[model samples]
Target: MTDDKIQELIGRCAERDVLAFEQLVRQFQSYAFALAMRLLCNEEEASDAVQESFVRVWKHLDRYDRGRKFTTWLYTIVTNISLDRLRAIKRNRRLFSSRDEDPSIDDIQDERDLHEIHSNEELAGMIRALTDELPLKQRLVFTLRDLQDLSVEEVSEASGMSIGSVKTNLHYARRRIRQRMAEKYNVERLES
Candidate 1:
């Protein structure tokens, strides 16, 4: 959907128009759900977070500034909600168990020729495992910058961090992931 259309929907939504709100939800639900899934790592939890975030968005529509990007504002809400949920889960897990083994990074190397196929689900799973090892701030920056292909400024805005901090986190996150991949796959041959 176009920004103008989204803005119009937001305007109507702000006025308590139920149809416009429904339309807005349909337009942005997938994007929000994907983001929540990436952050929360479980489909059920992500769905719940997405639903809650939308409810909060509707409740706080009047606070949304028309001058800013609507999607960005919506993302901020969803991301914050997902982070809170994640933190709560982590806290609960810590309280309930002493298990500390990290999740295994899935093998992502493709058996097919690199030029023929770009299946990266395994790679994505590995990346996700590595990402899970990162601190929340670094993980958020890395996901937004590398996975989502957002600019540093956009990541900064989404994460409420400075551009420098975003850049730094992305740099380290990419470096660490690459280092892990190299160790797992044999760096010299892969490079060649």
Candidate 2:
């Protein structure tokens, strides 16, 4: 949907129009959930985060600036919530020590090779797994840039970082992904 349409919806949503709110939810659900998933790395948590964000957005709809891009503003909300969720999860995991650690990439070579023969979904899953190895900022940058196809400026805006930081994080993310692919899959393409 276009920004104008989204702005119209937001205007209606600000008045507590249920249909307009539903329309907004329908339009941005996938984008919101995908971003949450990338940040949280858990399907259930991502789903919860998306739902919670919508509730928060609904309650705060009047605060939305109509002059700005609606989707960008919505993304900022979901991204902040997802980051908070991630931090909470990390703290809980550290407190409980309930989750077993994953094996190193080298140890998962056989599984990685098998994953390579599958469809793009499998490849995406492998990439997501590799992303978990990256630092949080780098992972967010990579997901926003490579997966979501956001521009550097958009990523910088969403991440609250400078454009140069976004570029550097993306560079490190791509390099790490390529290095992992080479080590695990024996694939040697220069371009990802």
Top model number, TM-score: 1
Output the lDDT of residue 13, model 1: 90
Q: List the residue pairs that clash in candidate 1.
A: 108-123
lDDT of 1 by residue, 46-133 (tens): 8999999999999999898888888788888988998899899779878886444434444334423222423334433554566876
Off by over 4 Å in 1: 98-102, 106-124, 188-192
Error of 1 at 191 (Å): 9.3
Off by over 4 Å in 2: 98-125, 190-192
Ten contiguous residues with the weakest lDDT in model 2 = 112-121
Report per-prediction Cα RMSD to one decimal. 3.5, 3.3
lDDT of 2 by residue, 45-121 (tens): 88999999999999988887777677777788888898888779768877987545533355444643543434534
> CA lDDT, every prediction?
0.77, 0.78
Weakest ten-residue segment in model 1 by summed lDDT: 111-120
